[model samples]
Target: MAIFTMMNSLAALLLFLISSSSLIAASDSPFILAHKKATLNRLKSGAEKLSVSIDIYNQGSATAYDVSLNDDGWSSDIFSIISGNTSTSWERLDAGALLSHSFELESNVKTVFYSSPAVITFRVPTKAALQEAYSTPLLPLEILSDKPRESTLDLAKRALAKYGSLISVISIVVLFVYLVATPSKSGAAKGSKKKR
Candidate 1:
Protein backbone atom coordinates (compact mmCIF):
# COMPACT_ATOMS: atom_id res chain seq x y z
CA MET A 1 0.00 0.00 0.00
CA ALA A 2 2.93 2.43 0.74
CA ILE A 3 4.55 1.67 -2.63
CA PHE A 4 1.21 2.37 -4.36
CA THR A 5 0.90 5.76 -2.66
CA MET A 6 4.50 6.70 -3.70
CA MET A 7 3.72 5.80 -7.31
CA ASN A 8 0.65 8.11 -7.22
CA SER A 9 2.75 11.01 -5.80
CA LEU A 10 5.43 10.53 -8.51
CA ALA A 11 2.80 10.59 -11.28
CA ALA A 12 1.24 13.77 -9.86
CA LEU A 13 4.63 15.50 -9.73
CA LEU A 14 5.31 14.61 -13.37
CA LEU A 15 1.93 15.97 -14.44
CA PHE A 16 2.48 19.21 -12.57
CA LEU A 17 5.88 19.75 -14.19
CA ILE A 18 4.54 19.13 -17.68
CA SER A 19 1.60 21.55 -17.17
CA SER A 20 3.84 24.35 -15.86
CA SER A 21 6.30 23.97 -18.74
CA SER A 22 3.47 24.32 -21.27
CA LEU A 23 2.30 27.52 -19.62
CA ILE A 24 5.82 28.91 -19.82
CA ALA A 25 6.09 28.03 -23.54
CA ALA A 26 2.66 29.58 -24.31
CA SER A 27 3.79 33.00 -23.03
CA ASP A 28 6.56 33.37 -25.61
CA SER A 29 6.11 36.01 -28.37
CA PRO A 30 7.57 36.45 -31.80
CA PHE A 31 11.34 36.86 -32.11
CA ILE A 32 12.74 38.67 -35.12
CA LEU A 33 16.33 38.27 -36.36
CA ALA A 34 18.04 40.19 -39.14
CA HIS A 35 21.32 39.69 -41.01
CA LYS A 36 23.07 41.85 -43.62
CA LYS A 37 26.02 41.29 -45.93
CA ALA A 38 27.83 43.36 -48.58
CA THR A 39 29.99 42.12 -51.43
CA LEU A 40 32.26 44.06 -53.84
CA ASN A 41 32.45 43.59 -57.59
CA ARG A 42 34.79 45.10 -60.16
CA LEU A 43 33.07 45.98 -63.39
CA LYS A 44 34.46 45.54 -66.89
CA SER A 45 34.53 49.32 -67.25
CA GLY A 46 36.93 49.54 -64.28
CA ALA A 47 34.19 50.65 -61.91
CA GLU A 48 33.77 49.35 -58.37
CA LYS A 49 30.36 48.41 -57.03
CA LEU A 50 28.79 46.89 -53.95
CA SER A 51 25.91 44.48 -53.67
CA VAL A 52 24.01 44.41 -50.39
CA SER A 53 21.83 41.55 -49.17
CA ILE A 54 19.57 41.55 -46.13
CA ASP A 55 17.72 38.64 -44.56
CA ILE A 56 14.91 38.83 -42.00
CA TYR A 57 13.82 35.76 -40.09
CA ASN A 58 11.00 35.15 -37.63
CA GLN A 59 12.23 32.67 -35.05
CA GLY A 60 9.56 32.78 -32.36
CA SER A 61 6.34 30.80 -31.94
CA ALA A 62 4.04 33.69 -32.91
CA THR A 63 3.68 35.58 -36.17
CA ALA A 64 4.98 39.10 -36.74
CA TYR A 65 2.81 41.67 -38.54
CA ASP A 66 3.77 44.85 -40.41
CA VAL A 67 7.33 43.67 -40.84
CA SER A 68 9.59 46.42 -42.19
CA LEU A 69 13.29 46.61 -43.09
CA ASN A 70 15.22 49.86 -43.36
CA ASP A 71 18.81 50.15 -44.58
CA ASP A 72 19.39 53.84 -45.23
CA GLY A 73 22.71 53.59 -43.47
CA TRP A 74 24.99 55.12 -46.07
CA SER A 75 25.31 58.60 -47.43
CA SER A 76 23.38 59.15 -50.65
CA ASP A 77 25.93 61.53 -52.10
CA ILE A 78 28.73 59.04 -51.73
CA PHE A 79 26.84 55.93 -52.77
CA SER A 80 24.27 56.06 -55.53
CA ILE A 81 21.76 53.30 -56.08
CA ILE A 82 22.37 51.23 -59.14
CA SER A 83 19.25 49.11 -58.69
CA GLY A 84 16.55 48.20 -56.14
CA ASN A 85 15.41 50.16 -53.11
CA THR A 86 17.11 50.16 -49.73
CA SER A 87 13.96 49.57 -47.72
CA THR A 88 10.99 47.23 -48.02
CA SER A 89 7.84 46.29 -46.11
CA TRP A 90 5.70 43.21 -45.78
CA GLU A 91 2.27 42.54 -44.37
CA ARG A 92 3.19 39.60 -42.19
CA LEU A 93 6.03 37.21 -41.43
CA ASP A 94 4.93 33.89 -40.01
CA ALA A 95 6.90 31.87 -37.50
CA GLY A 96 10.04 30.28 -38.99
CA ALA A 97 9.64 32.41 -42.12
CA LEU A 98 12.56 34.19 -43.84
CA LEU A 99 12.60 37.20 -46.17
CA SER A 100 15.49 38.45 -48.29
CA HIS A 101 16.23 41.81 -49.94
CA SER A 102 19.07 42.85 -52.22
CA PHE A 103 20.32 46.12 -53.76
CA GLU A 104 23.25 47.35 -55.81
CA LEU A 105 25.25 50.50 -55.06
CA GLU A 106 28.05 52.29 -56.87
CA SER A 107 30.53 54.94 -55.78
CA ASN A 108 32.77 56.88 -58.13
CA VAL A 109 34.75 58.69 -55.47
CA LYS A 110 37.66 56.98 -53.75
CA THR A 111 36.93 56.76 -50.06
CA VAL A 112 36.54 54.28 -47.19
CA PHE A 113 33.02 53.24 -46.27
CA TYR A 114 31.62 52.72 -42.74
CA SER A 115 28.20 51.07 -42.74
CA SER A 116 25.58 51.25 -39.99
CA PRO A 117 23.40 48.43 -38.72
CA ALA A 118 20.05 47.98 -40.45
CA VAL A 119 16.80 48.41 -38.54
CA ILE A 120 13.99 45.84 -38.48
CA THR A 121 10.63 46.51 -36.87
CA PHE A 122 7.58 44.34 -36.48
CA ARG A 123 4.41 44.07 -34.40
CA VAL A 124 3.58 40.92 -32.45
CA PRO A 125 -0.01 39.76 -32.28
CA THR A 126 0.16 39.29 -28.52
CA LYS A 127 1.68 42.67 -27.69
CA ALA A 128 0.60 46.27 -28.32
CA ALA A 129 4.18 47.63 -28.36
CA LEU A 130 6.32 47.38 -31.48
CA GLN A 131 9.50 45.29 -31.34
CA GLU A 132 12.68 46.41 -33.06
CA ALA A 133 15.96 44.65 -33.83
CA TYR A 134 19.23 45.71 -35.42
CA SER A 135 21.25 43.70 -37.85
CA THR A 136 24.90 42.74 -37.23
CA PRO A 137 27.44 45.46 -37.95
CA LEU A 138 30.02 45.01 -40.69
CA LEU A 139 33.66 46.05 -40.98
CA PRO A 140 34.86 49.09 -42.91
CA LEU A 141 35.24 48.67 -46.68
CA GLU A 142 37.91 50.31 -48.80
CA ILE A 143 36.58 51.57 -52.12
CA LEU A 144 39.70 52.57 -54.03
CA SER A 145 41.99 50.21 -52.28
CA ASP A 146 41.14 46.61 -52.90
CA LYS A 147 38.69 45.68 -50.17
CA PRO A 148 40.22 42.25 -49.72
CA ARG A 149 43.68 41.14 -50.70
CA GLU A 150 43.95 37.98 -52.78
CA SER A 151 45.82 34.96 -51.43
CA THR A 152 49.06 33.97 -53.19
CA LEU A 153 47.43 30.68 -54.17
CA ASP A 154 44.52 32.55 -55.78
CA LEU A 155 46.88 34.90 -57.64
CA ALA A 156 48.92 31.96 -58.96
CA LYS A 157 45.78 30.18 -60.08
CA ARG A 158 44.55 33.26 -61.96
CA ALA A 159 47.91 33.83 -63.60
CA LEU A 160 48.08 30.20 -64.75
CA ALA A 161 44.60 30.42 -66.18
CA LYS A 162 45.29 33.61 -68.14
CA TYR A 163 48.79 32.64 -69.38
CA GLY A 164 48.50 28.87 -69.56
CA SER A 165 48.76 28.58 -73.35
CA LEU A 166 51.71 30.96 -73.48
CA ILE A 167 53.59 28.95 -70.87
CA SER A 168 52.88 25.73 -72.74
CA VAL A 169 54.11 27.19 -76.03
CA ILE A 170 57.31 28.46 -74.39
CA SER A 171 58.00 25.04 -72.89
CA ILE A 172 57.54 23.30 -76.25
CA VAL A 173 59.80 25.82 -78.03
CA VAL A 174 62.53 25.39 -75.44
CA LEU A 175 62.40 21.61 -75.83
CA PHE A 176 62.64 21.86 -79.65
CA VAL A 177 65.60 24.29 -79.46
CA TYR A 178 67.44 21.99 -77.07
CA LEU A 179 66.95 19.01 -79.35
CA VAL A 180 68.12 20.95 -82.49
CA ALA A 181 71.19 22.55 -80.81
CA THR A 182 72.52 19.35 -79.25
CA PRO A 183 73.77 16.50 -81.63
CA SER A 184 73.18 12.87 -80.75
CA LYS A 185 76.17 10.72 -79.79
CA SER A 186 74.84 7.92 -82.01
CA GLY A 187 74.95 10.20 -85.11
CA ALA A 188 78.59 11.18 -84.42
CA ALA A 189 79.64 7.53 -83.94
CA LYS A 190 77.95 6.46 -87.19
CA GLY A 191 79.62 9.25 -89.17
CA SER A 192 83.05 8.33 -87.79
CA LYS A 193 82.56 4.66 -88.75
CA LYS A 194 81.46 5.55 -92.29
CA LYS A 195 84.49 7.78 -92.79
CA ARG A 196 86.82 4.96 -91.66
Candidate 2:
Protein backbone atom coordinates (compact mmCIF):
# COMPACT_ATOMS: atom_id res chain seq x y z
CA MET A 1 0.00 0.00 0.00
CA ALA A 2 2.86 2.41 0.81
CA ILE A 3 4.56 1.64 -2.52
CA PHE A 4 1.33 2.35 -4.40
CA THR A 5 0.90 5.64 -2.55
CA MET A 6 4.47 6.68 -3.39
CA MET A 7 3.88 5.99 -7.07
CA ASN A 8 0.69 8.04 -7.01
CA SER A 9 2.47 10.98 -5.36
CA LEU A 10 5.28 10.89 -7.91
CA ALA A 11 2.77 10.90 -10.79
CA ALA A 12 0.95 13.91 -9.33
CA LEU A 13 4.19 15.91 -9.01
CA LEU A 14 5.12 15.11 -12.62
CA LEU A 15 1.73 16.26 -13.88
CA PHE A 16 1.96 19.48 -11.93
CA LEU A 17 5.40 20.30 -13.30
CA ILE A 18 4.31 19.64 -16.89
CA SER A 19 1.17 21.77 -16.56
CA SER A 20 3.09 24.72 -15.10
CA SER A 21 5.76 24.60 -17.77
CA SER A 22 3.14 24.55 -20.52
CA LEU A 23 1.35 27.53 -19.03
CA ILE A 24 4.55 29.56 -18.92
CA ALA A 25 5.36 28.73 -22.52
CA ALA A 26 1.89 29.74 -23.66
CA SER A 27 2.21 33.19 -22.14
CA ASP A 28 5.36 34.10 -24.04
CA SER A 29 4.63 32.52 -27.42
CA PRO A 30 2.84 35.38 -29.14
CA PHE A 31 5.21 38.32 -28.89
CA ILE A 32 5.54 40.98 -31.56
CA LEU A 33 7.08 44.40 -32.28
CA ALA A 34 6.85 47.18 -34.84
CA HIS A 35 9.93 48.65 -36.52
CA LYS A 36 10.68 51.32 -39.11
CA LYS A 37 12.98 51.10 -42.12
CA ALA A 38 14.81 53.62 -44.28
CA THR A 39 17.31 53.35 -47.08
CA LEU A 40 20.28 55.52 -48.05
CA ASN A 41 20.58 54.45 -51.67
CA ARG A 42 24.03 55.59 -52.72
CA LEU A 43 26.10 53.47 -50.36
CA LYS A 44 25.15 49.89 -51.22
CA SER A 45 27.94 49.27 -53.67
CA GLY A 46 27.83 45.51 -53.99
CA ALA A 47 27.14 45.51 -50.28
CA GLU A 48 24.02 45.15 -48.16
CA LYS A 49 23.77 47.38 -45.11
CA LEU A 50 20.32 47.68 -43.61
CA SER A 51 19.39 49.97 -40.79
CA VAL A 52 16.39 49.30 -38.51
CA SER A 53 14.87 52.16 -36.54
CA ILE A 54 12.18 51.35 -33.99
CA ASP A 55 10.59 54.77 -33.70
CA ILE A 56 7.29 53.86 -32.08
CA TYR A 57 6.51 52.26 -28.75
CA ASN A 58 4.62 49.00 -28.18
CA GLN A 59 4.07 48.80 -31.88
CA GLY A 60 4.11 45.02 -31.79
CA SER A 61 3.94 42.46 -29.04
CA ALA A 62 5.06 38.86 -29.11
CA THR A 63 6.35 36.36 -26.70
CA ALA A 64 10.09 35.84 -27.15
CA TYR A 65 10.55 34.97 -30.83
CA ASP A 66 13.18 34.92 -33.53
CA VAL A 67 13.98 36.80 -36.74
CA SER A 68 15.16 35.55 -40.12
CA LEU A 69 16.24 37.25 -43.31
CA ASN A 70 15.79 35.90 -46.81
CA ASP A 71 19.01 34.03 -47.45
CA ASP A 72 18.80 33.20 -51.13
CA GLY A 73 22.09 34.07 -52.88
CA TRP A 74 23.16 35.84 -49.72
CA SER A 75 26.45 36.69 -48.07
CA SER A 76 27.36 38.82 -45.11
CA ASP A 77 30.02 41.39 -46.07
CA ILE A 78 30.28 42.49 -42.47
CA PHE A 79 28.27 40.82 -39.74
CA SER A 80 28.04 42.88 -36.59
CA ILE A 81 26.11 43.00 -33.32
CA ILE A 82 25.42 46.47 -31.98
CA SER A 83 23.69 47.85 -28.91
CA GLY A 84 21.13 50.59 -28.50
CA ASN A 85 19.99 51.98 -25.14
CA THR A 86 18.78 48.77 -23.47
CA SER A 87 22.11 46.98 -23.37
CA THR A 88 22.02 46.34 -19.65
CA SER A 89 18.50 44.90 -19.60
CA TRP A 90 18.28 42.36 -22.42
CA GLU A 91 19.28 38.75 -22.19
CA ARG A 92 22.20 37.77 -24.44
CA LEU A 93 22.78 34.62 -26.44
CA ASP A 94 25.67 32.25 -25.88
CA ALA A 95 27.25 31.53 -29.25
CA GLY A 96 30.50 30.20 -27.69
CA ALA A 97 33.91 31.57 -26.74
CA LEU A 98 35.53 33.83 -29.36
CA LEU A 99 32.06 33.98 -30.95
CA SER A 100 30.12 35.15 -27.92
CA HIS A 101 28.32 38.42 -28.54
CA SER A 102 25.30 40.29 -27.19
CA PHE A 103 21.88 40.25 -28.92
CA GLU A 104 19.87 42.65 -26.84
CA LEU A 105 16.49 43.91 -27.96
CA GLU A 106 15.63 47.59 -28.03
CA SER A 107 13.30 48.96 -25.39
CA ASN A 108 10.43 51.44 -25.30
CA VAL A 109 11.21 54.90 -26.80
CA LYS A 110 14.68 53.84 -27.90
CA THR A 111 16.08 53.33 -31.38
CA VAL A 112 18.84 51.03 -32.59
CA PHE A 113 20.18 50.74 -36.09
CA TYR A 114 23.09 49.02 -37.77
CA SER A 115 25.54 51.02 -39.92
CA SER A 116 26.46 49.44 -43.24
CA PRO A 117 25.17 46.39 -41.50
CA ALA A 118 25.10 43.01 -43.17
CA VAL A 119 21.69 41.51 -43.78
CA ILE A 120 20.75 38.89 -41.23
CA THR A 121 19.95 35.40 -42.46
CA PHE A 122 17.75 34.59 -39.52
CA ARG A 123 17.24 34.60 -35.75
CA VAL A 124 16.72 31.25 -34.08
CA PRO A 125 14.45 29.75 -31.40
CA THR A 126 11.45 30.61 -33.49
CA LYS A 127 7.80 31.27 -32.64
CA ALA A 128 7.18 27.57 -32.26
CA ALA A 129 9.94 27.44 -29.74
CA LEU A 130 8.24 30.19 -27.80
CA GLN A 131 5.01 28.23 -27.88
CA GLU A 132 6.81 25.19 -26.63
CA ALA A 133 8.60 27.15 -23.95
CA TYR A 134 5.58 29.00 -22.61
CA SER A 135 2.62 27.25 -24.29
CA THR A 136 1.65 30.56 -25.92
CA PRO A 137 1.84 31.67 -29.53
CA LEU A 138 4.80 33.87 -30.39
CA LEU A 139 4.14 37.58 -30.00
CA PRO A 140 3.09 39.51 -33.07
CA LEU A 141 5.45 42.03 -34.64
CA GLU A 142 4.15 44.96 -36.66
CA ILE A 143 6.58 46.77 -38.94
CA LEU A 144 5.64 50.42 -38.42
CA SER A 145 7.52 52.18 -41.21
CA ASP A 146 7.33 51.47 -44.87
CA LYS A 147 9.06 48.28 -45.81
CA PRO A 148 12.67 48.64 -46.86
CA ARG A 149 12.93 50.10 -50.32
CA GLU A 150 15.50 48.59 -52.65
CA SER A 151 17.86 51.05 -54.32
CA THR A 152 21.40 49.81 -54.90
CA LEU A 153 22.71 53.13 -56.15
CA ASP A 154 21.14 55.03 -53.28
CA LEU A 155 22.72 52.66 -50.80
CA ALA A 156 26.17 53.05 -52.36
CA LYS A 157 25.91 56.81 -52.38
CA ARG A 158 24.69 56.99 -48.83
CA ALA A 159 27.46 54.73 -47.58
CA LEU A 160 30.11 56.80 -49.33
CA ALA A 161 28.68 60.08 -48.11
CA LYS A 162 28.42 58.94 -44.50
CA TYR A 163 31.89 57.40 -44.36
CA GLY A 164 33.57 59.69 -46.88
CA SER A 165 35.12 62.21 -44.51
CA LEU A 166 36.56 59.59 -42.23
CA ILE A 167 38.12 57.78 -45.16
CA SER A 168 39.66 60.95 -46.60
CA VAL A 169 41.08 61.96 -43.21
CA ILE A 170 42.66 58.58 -42.71
CA SER A 171 44.20 58.64 -46.16
CA ILE A 172 45.70 62.09 -45.68
CA VAL A 173 47.10 61.23 -42.27
CA VAL A 174 48.67 58.02 -43.58
CA LEU A 175 50.27 59.83 -46.50
CA PHE A 176 51.66 62.52 -44.24
CA VAL A 177 53.09 59.96 -41.82
CA TYR A 178 54.74 58.07 -44.70
CA LEU A 179 56.34 61.23 -46.02
CA VAL A 180 57.67 62.17 -42.57
CA ALA A 181 59.02 58.73 -41.72
CA THR A 182 60.67 57.87 -45.05
CA PRO A 183 64.14 59.36 -45.62
CA SER A 184 64.45 61.39 -48.85
CA LYS A 185 67.38 60.69 -51.21
CA SER A 186 69.03 64.01 -50.27
CA GLY A 187 68.66 63.20 -46.56
CA ALA A 188 70.25 59.77 -47.03
CA ALA A 189 73.18 61.34 -49.00
CA LYS A 190 73.64 63.99 -46.31
CA GLY A 191 73.78 61.32 -43.64
CA SER A 192 76.52 59.45 -45.55
CA LYS A 193 78.54 62.65 -45.94
CA LYS A 194 78.24 63.38 -42.25
CA LYS A 195 79.55 59.88 -41.48
CA ARG A 196 82.64 60.54 -43.70
Candidate 3:
Protein backbone atom coordinates (compact mmCIF):
# COMPACT_ATOMS: atom_id res chain seq x y z
CA MET A 1 0.00 0.00 0.00
CA ALA A 2 2.87 2.44 0.78
CA ILE A 3 4.56 1.55 -2.45
CA PHE A 4 1.38 2.39 -4.34
CA THR A 5 1.15 5.74 -2.58
CA MET A 6 4.79 6.57 -3.38
CA MET A 7 4.27 5.73 -7.07
CA ASN A 8 1.23 7.99 -7.25
CA SER A 9 3.13 10.94 -5.67
CA LEU A 10 6.04 10.48 -8.07
CA ALA A 11 3.69 10.48 -11.07
CA ALA A 12 1.92 13.61 -9.81
CA LEU A 13 5.27 15.47 -9.38
CA LEU A 14 6.37 14.50 -12.89
CA LEU A 15 3.07 15.68 -14.34
CA PHE A 16 3.26 18.98 -12.49
CA LEU A 17 6.81 19.63 -13.68
CA ILE A 18 5.87 18.87 -17.29
CA SER A 19 2.86 21.20 -17.14
CA SER A 20 4.90 24.03 -15.58
CA SER A 21 7.67 23.69 -18.12
CA SER A 22 5.20 23.81 -20.97
CA LEU A 23 3.57 26.93 -19.56
CA ILE A 24 6.89 28.68 -19.15
CA ALA A 25 7.88 27.78 -22.68
CA ALA A 26 4.60 29.12 -24.04
CA SER A 27 4.82 32.43 -22.18
CA ASP A 28 8.54 33.01 -22.70
CA SER A 29 8.67 33.03 -26.51
CA PRO A 30 8.29 36.27 -28.46
CA PHE A 31 7.34 36.65 -32.09
CA ILE A 32 8.19 39.72 -34.10
CA LEU A 33 6.75 40.67 -37.50
CA ALA A 34 8.18 43.22 -39.86
CA HIS A 35 7.41 44.72 -43.28
CA LYS A 36 8.98 47.34 -45.55
CA LYS A 37 7.86 49.60 -48.41
CA ALA A 38 10.16 51.56 -50.70
CA THR A 39 9.86 54.21 -53.43
CA LEU A 40 12.54 55.24 -55.93
CA ASN A 41 12.90 58.55 -57.79
CA ARG A 42 15.33 58.73 -60.71
CA LEU A 43 17.11 61.98 -61.41
CA LYS A 44 18.14 63.42 -64.77
CA SER A 45 21.83 63.24 -63.84
CA GLY A 46 21.69 59.45 -63.48
CA ALA A 47 21.21 59.33 -59.72
CA GLU A 48 18.36 57.97 -57.65
CA LYS A 49 16.79 58.70 -54.28
CA LEU A 50 14.96 56.07 -52.32
CA SER A 51 12.45 56.41 -49.54
CA VAL A 52 11.69 53.45 -47.32
CA SER A 53 9.23 52.83 -44.52
CA ILE A 54 9.45 49.95 -42.07
CA ASP A 55 6.78 48.63 -39.74
CA ILE A 56 7.41 46.24 -36.85
CA TYR A 57 4.91 44.38 -34.73
CA ASN A 58 5.17 42.27 -31.60
CA GLN A 59 2.89 39.25 -31.89
CA GLY A 60 3.84 37.11 -28.93
CA SER A 61 2.31 37.02 -25.49
CA ALA A 62 5.31 38.51 -23.68
CA THR A 63 6.58 42.05 -23.64
CA ALA A 64 9.78 42.79 -25.57
CA TYR A 65 12.46 44.84 -23.83
CA ASP A 66 15.44 46.75 -25.18
CA VAL A 67 14.12 46.55 -28.71
CA SER A 68 16.37 47.94 -31.40
CA LEU A 69 17.01 47.81 -35.16
CA ASN A 70 20.18 47.19 -37.16
CA ASP A 71 21.24 47.17 -40.78
CA ASP A 72 22.87 43.96 -41.85
CA GLY A 73 24.28 44.27 -45.35
CA TRP A 74 23.64 47.81 -46.55
CA SER A 75 26.73 49.80 -47.54
CA SER A 76 27.36 53.40 -46.53
CA ASP A 77 28.75 54.51 -49.90
CA ILE A 78 25.86 53.08 -51.86
CA PHE A 79 23.14 54.23 -49.48
CA SER A 80 22.79 57.32 -47.35
CA ILE A 81 20.21 57.55 -44.60
CA ILE A 82 18.93 61.02 -45.21
CA SER A 83 15.76 61.20 -43.15
CA GLY A 84 15.65 58.56 -40.42
CA ASN A 85 17.92 56.43 -38.31
CA THR A 86 19.22 52.99 -39.21
CA SER A 87 19.07 52.01 -35.56
CA THR A 88 16.62 53.00 -32.85
CA SER A 89 15.81 51.90 -29.32
CA TRP A 90 12.54 51.35 -27.55
CA GLU A 91 12.11 50.81 -23.82
CA ARG A 92 9.49 48.16 -24.12
CA LEU A 93 6.89 46.92 -26.58
CA ASP A 94 3.86 45.04 -25.44
CA ALA A 95 2.30 42.24 -27.37
CA GLY A 96 0.28 43.36 -30.38
CA ALA A 97 2.15 46.66 -30.44
CA LEU A 98 3.47 48.27 -33.60
CA LEU A 99 6.37 50.62 -34.46
CA SER A 100 7.06 52.43 -37.69
CA HIS A 101 10.08 54.31 -39.08
CA SER A 102 11.04 55.92 -42.38
CA PHE A 103 14.40 56.36 -44.09
CA GLU A 104 15.51 58.19 -47.25
CA LEU A 105 18.54 57.05 -49.23
CA GLU A 106 20.41 58.23 -52.33
CA SER A 107 22.48 56.16 -54.75
CA ASN A 108 23.67 56.12 -58.31
CA VAL A 109 20.98 55.38 -60.88
CA LYS A 110 23.05 52.59 -62.39
CA THR A 111 21.91 50.26 -59.61
CA VAL A 112 18.80 48.79 -61.13
CA PHE A 113 17.76 46.67 -58.15
CA TYR A 114 18.37 46.77 -54.40
CA SER A 115 17.41 45.03 -51.14
CA SER A 116 18.24 46.46 -47.71
CA PRO A 117 18.61 44.14 -44.75
CA ALA A 118 16.83 44.94 -41.49
CA VAL A 119 17.34 43.17 -38.18
CA ILE A 120 15.43 43.54 -34.93
CA THR A 121 16.60 42.61 -31.47
CA PHE A 122 14.66 42.21 -28.24
CA ARG A 123 14.92 40.61 -24.84
CA VAL A 124 12.48 38.16 -23.29
CA PRO A 125 12.64 38.11 -19.50
CA THR A 126 10.85 34.84 -19.00
CA LYS A 127 13.48 32.98 -20.98
CA ALA A 128 16.27 35.40 -20.10
CA ALA A 129 17.20 35.33 -23.76
CA LEU A 130 18.15 38.00 -26.26
CA GLN A 131 16.63 37.19 -29.64
CA GLU A 132 17.03 38.54 -33.14
CA ALA A 133 14.54 38.58 -35.98
CA TYR A 134 15.03 39.62 -39.57
CA SER A 135 12.60 41.38 -41.82
CA THR A 136 11.23 39.53 -44.79
CA PRO A 137 13.08 40.17 -48.03
CA LEU A 138 12.43 43.80 -48.86
CA LEU A 139 10.74 44.48 -52.16
CA PRO A 140 13.32 45.66 -54.68
CA LEU A 141 13.25 49.29 -55.84
CA GLU A 142 13.43 49.88 -59.60
CA ILE A 143 14.54 53.23 -61.01
CA LEU A 144 12.58 54.61 -63.92
CA SER A 145 13.11 57.86 -65.79
CA ASP A 146 10.21 60.16 -66.56
CA LYS A 147 12.00 62.14 -69.21
CA PRO A 148 9.82 63.80 -71.86
CA ARG A 149 9.78 62.25 -75.31
CA GLU A 150 10.53 64.17 -78.52
CA SER A 151 7.52 65.58 -80.35
CA THR A 152 6.67 65.07 -84.02
CA LEU A 153 7.73 68.64 -84.83
CA ASP A 154 11.05 68.08 -83.13
CA LEU A 155 11.60 64.89 -85.10
CA ALA A 156 10.82 66.64 -88.35
CA LYS A 157 13.27 69.43 -87.53
CA ARG A 158 15.98 66.91 -86.84
CA ALA A 159 15.26 65.09 -90.11
CA LEU A 160 15.37 68.35 -92.02
CA ALA A 161 18.68 69.23 -90.44
CA LYS A 162 20.14 65.88 -91.55
CA TYR A 163 18.64 65.93 -95.11
CA GLY A 164 18.61 69.63 -96.00
CA SER A 165 19.41 69.16 -99.72
CA LEU A 166 16.75 66.50 -100.31
CA ILE A 167 14.08 68.59 -98.55
CA SER A 168 15.08 71.71 -100.51
CA VAL A 169 14.70 69.83 -103.82
CA ILE A 170 11.26 68.55 -102.79
CA SER A 171 10.21 72.12 -101.85
CA ILE A 172 11.26 73.41 -105.31
CA VAL A 173 9.32 70.64 -107.06
CA VAL A 174 6.14 71.51 -105.06
CA LEU A 175 6.49 75.23 -105.95
CA PHE A 176 6.85 74.43 -109.66
CA VAL A 177 3.69 72.30 -109.54
CA TYR A 178 1.77 75.22 -107.94
CA LEU A 179 2.91 77.71 -110.61
CA VAL A 180 2.05 75.36 -113.53
CA ALA A 181 -1.40 74.59 -112.09
CA THR A 182 -2.43 78.32 -111.72
CA PRO A 183 -2.90 80.50 -114.86
CA SER A 184 -0.73 83.66 -114.69
CA LYS A 185 -1.42 87.24 -116.04
CA SER A 186 1.84 87.20 -118.06
CA GLY A 187 0.84 83.93 -119.80
CA ALA A 188 -2.63 85.35 -120.61
CA ALA A 189 -1.12 88.63 -121.98
CA LYS A 190 1.28 86.71 -124.25
CA GLY A 191 -1.52 84.48 -125.52
CA SER A 192 -3.73 87.56 -126.34
CA LYS A 193 -0.86 89.26 -128.20
CA LYS A 194 -0.28 86.15 -130.28
CA LYS A 195 -4.02 85.96 -131.11
CA ARG A 196 -4.07 89.68 -132.15
Task: Name the best candidate (by lDDT).
Answer: 1
- Model with the higher TM-score, candidate 1 or 2: 1
TM-scores, all candidates, are 0.62, 0.25, 0.55
Residue pairs whose backbone atoms clash in candidate 3: none
The TM-score of candidate 3 is: 0.55
lDDT score, candidate 2, position 49: 36
Question: Model 1 segments beyond 4 Å from truth?
Answer: 1-27, 146-196
Q: Give the Å error, residue 168, model 2.
A: 0.8
Give the TM-score ranking, best first. Answer: 1, 3, 2
Steric overlap count per candidate: 0, 50, 0
Q: Give the TM-score of candidate 2.
A: 0.25
lDDT of each: 0.87, 0.38, 0.78
- lDDT comparing candidate 2 with the true structure: 0.38
Candidates ranked, most accurate by lDDT first? 1, 3, 2
Tens-digit per-residue lDDT, 1-196, candidate 3: 9999999999999999899757755875667888877778776667788877778888777788998887545567677666777778788888879988777887764544667668999988875668888876766555554548999999999998999989899999999999999999999999999998
> Per-residue lDDT tens digits of candidate 1, residues 68-179?
8999997987888999999999999998899999999997767888999999999887789988999988788777575578899999999999999999999999999999
What is the C-alpha lDDT profile of model 2 across 81-177, one tens digit per residue? 2333211212322221111112323222112323222222212354333221111122223212235786999998999999999999999999999
Poorly placed runs, candidate 3 (over 4 Å): 1-28, 44-46, 144-196
Top-scoring candidate (TM-score) = 1
